[model samples]
Target: MEGPIEIRGLTKVYGGGFKAVDDLNFVVPKNAFMGFLGPNGAGKTTSIKIITNMLSATSGEAIINGINVMSDPKMALADVGAVVETPEFYPYLTPMETLLYLGSLRGMTNTEITNRGRDLLDMVKLTEWKDQRVGKFSKGMKQRLAIAQALLPQPSVIILDEPTSGLDPRGMVEVRDILKELRKIDVSVLMSSHLLNEVQEVCTDVTLINRGKMLRSGSVASLLNEVKAHKIEVRVLSPPALEVTNQLRSFPGVKEINYMSDVVFNVDFEGAEAEQAGLLLQLQGMGLKVVSFKESGLALESLYMSLIMESR
Candidate 1:
């Protein structure tokens, strides 16, 4: 099936012959929340620029909803909403006023603007500050407002560039929460980010890239399944006895164990979800009060790092 967003042979070269994007190809499946990931200088931003029509591609096609972006930018991008890099807004305008102005530019009626603007502000948890000047708002608030503006037109596809890049922990959580809410909507999202945990938490699929080249791309579960083993952290209510540790070490799928302390240890576990559940049961059956049993390393992070290393 044709996706909402597709890149075929996309490439970008600067005057210095620096290849920012190199023959990239991928698709943002309909209704899929996909993360575009890579390290610094990995061409993620450049590819997004091309797809959003902010920059022209040297050689390739950026097709949005099946329309060629370079051939008909206005039409291709008509159904798309984008937030690129740090979103900047007029410092003097209130959130409502900013939305109204941008909505007008999109040719929305006053009534449509007011209703949609109010709804979006509420969705992003900015309804209380809807009338406040943007200058007084924190970076997190501004980012939320930016999202409201992007969604003002009710576009079908949303593109975000590191939506949580510069926020503090609280701010990052806020933005991530908004993204989770976004999942409830029917829009297809293609977000570019380097944060592994963020993607693992919110994105259903991921596309990995490096030095302007495609590394791997697929649904999160499929990619994670490629990981042969996971490092799990197991914490018990009390320090485990030697015999308890011995039993744990002998458990099936437990490849290796590294004790962090008497109460906590890391297990190199080669198992599926069912096996993991069994391991937890086994720990409980041993009369140990398990406090936590969770994967210490993100499966996506492991896969992403390994692919990047191989590419280098």
Candidate 2:
């Protein structure tokens, strides 16, 4: 079956001969939460604009649900919901009123708007303030409401551009929680974000881009597997003796070990998950009280940086 979103040879150029997007091609598979990752001015937003039919592409196709956006924008976008860049609404309108108004624009009947609007308000945790004016809401609340509005249409595909941008830490977390909820539904999502941690947390698949060119695209697990080595931090109740440390250093796949303190150290491990499990078992068998064992550093962050650097 065709994916919900596909880009083939999509490119965008400005008047001065500068290309903002360059032949980008990828697919947002059915029910997949895909992250569109890139650095600033890397053409992430430009590509999204083309896909959403907000801007004309220099060359290429933006297909949504098997419909070409350029050829039939209204039909192509009928079941598409997008929150592009920062979202703003009339301060005077309440959340319900706002949805009702937007829904009307989308040709929804009054009954349909009220029923879905109420349910969506609850989904976004804005039920208490559904009737409250949007002007008094915080940035986080507004962002949440924006997501609710996008979902009001019961879209088959959801597109978001930096949904958590310009928000505080709590606000970012709230938006991320909403995104997590999105994954539970049947819709396919394409979220454009530069924040690696955010993408890693909420997206199952990722496509990396740099300078408007495609770098790599795959499931998060597959991309992480491309990183042959992993850093793991282990904490024990007490420090190990020098001989025990030496034994640990000699363990298979232990490239290096650095002691951060008496009970905490990091292991540069070179192997897959099974090898990592072996290392953990070896630690427990050493007669040390193991407190915690977890991977250190963002593997995706490392891959993203390397790809971006290489592209440059």
Candidate 3:
């Protein structure tokens, strides 16, 4: 059950000499749920395609466990399961039938398929729908089935691209719950998504990419800590006037303010530790009843924007 996915100096050049992935280098640790993060067209998908052997890299290497994908894709990817995008199942096939067909293609015996299929269906909470036609399933149900399909081969590492993309709120939650379950099973998952919150919630580590270049790679906590910024949530006894709100925004160290409710709001403050401490005092001095004040972790959205802007 080896799970490390290593990429060294990987590069992908298109016909017009545009490089989609430029000498990217990183490693998804064994049994780590790592997020492959980037803006659209930032080579996230291209790098993943190279790893899955769907697209050939112009140069460099992708090694899964100890085997090189470029040298021998079959052996390297034999234990890898990937859901690059939403896959369409046959309209008439039941979940059980679809899995059995897929399992047979993978050279599993009928007994193996039946036993493993049942386990996977249960894992995905699809036991009740196992015999139901896929045509009647919702987008979320289809996604759950897709995950079951990926697990049928007992892969140690699962690669998913935007697994929650295009789903409704409930569907997103369903998919996210499944990802959380994978973490409990010691299955390394490399999931690519633009949703920063999703990565923050589901991934232990992350590799950030922009314009075919690696921006940062580290544990989520470490990355957030590295951001030399502060977001503070403040609660007041009552909402302030327009002028008072404007005054806070125009403060020397305050970068932005977002109203959460009548008496609560969050502010992005860029200042030293001393300045942050003085902010609450300053608000109180302005005749506002500052009920509570605390520094919040840098939001993934803010961190991402900061990095993206800095990269640009």
Greater-lDDT candidate between 1 and 3: 1
How far residue 110's Cα lies from its native spot in candidate 1, in Å, is 1.0
RMSD of each: 3.8, 3.6, 3.2
TM-score ranking from best candidate downward = 3, 1, 2
Q: Candidate 2's error at 240, in angstroms?
A: 12
- Candidate 2 Cα RMSD (Å): 3.6
Please, what are the lDDT tens digits per residue for candidate 3 over residues 1-312?
A: 233798889999999999899999988988889999999999998999999999999999999878999999988988888888787889899999998898887788889988999998997889999999999898888988999998888888889988998899988998898899888986788999999889999999999999999989878888876665678999999998989999999888898999999999998887767888788888998999988998775366667778899999
* Candidate 2: pairs in clash: none
| Model 1 agreement with the true structure over 1-312: per-residue lDDT tens digits | 479999999999989999999999999999999999999889999999899989999999999999999999989988888999887899999999999898887789989999999999998899999888999898888998888888889899999999998999998998999899889999999999999999999999999999999999899999998975788999999998888889889999898889998889999888788899999998899999999999887888878877898998
lDDT of 2 by residue, 1-312 (tens): 269999999999999999999999999899999999999999999999888888999999999999999999999999998998877789999999999998987899999999999998998899999989999898889888999999988999999999999999988988898999999999999999999999999999999999899999989999988875788999999889999999999999998899999999999887888889999999999997899999988999868877887888
Worst-scoring 10-residue span by lDDT in model 2:
301-310
Q: Is candidate 1 or candidate 2 better by TM-score?
A: 1
- The TM-scores, one per candidate, come to 0.83, 0.82, 0.86
Q: After superposing candidate 1, which stretches have Cα over 4 Å from the reference?
A: 232-294
- Model 3 score (lDDT): 0.88
Clashing pairs in 3: none
Write down the lDDT of every candidate, Cα atoms only: 0.91, 0.92, 0.88
Model 1 TM-score, all chains together = 0.83
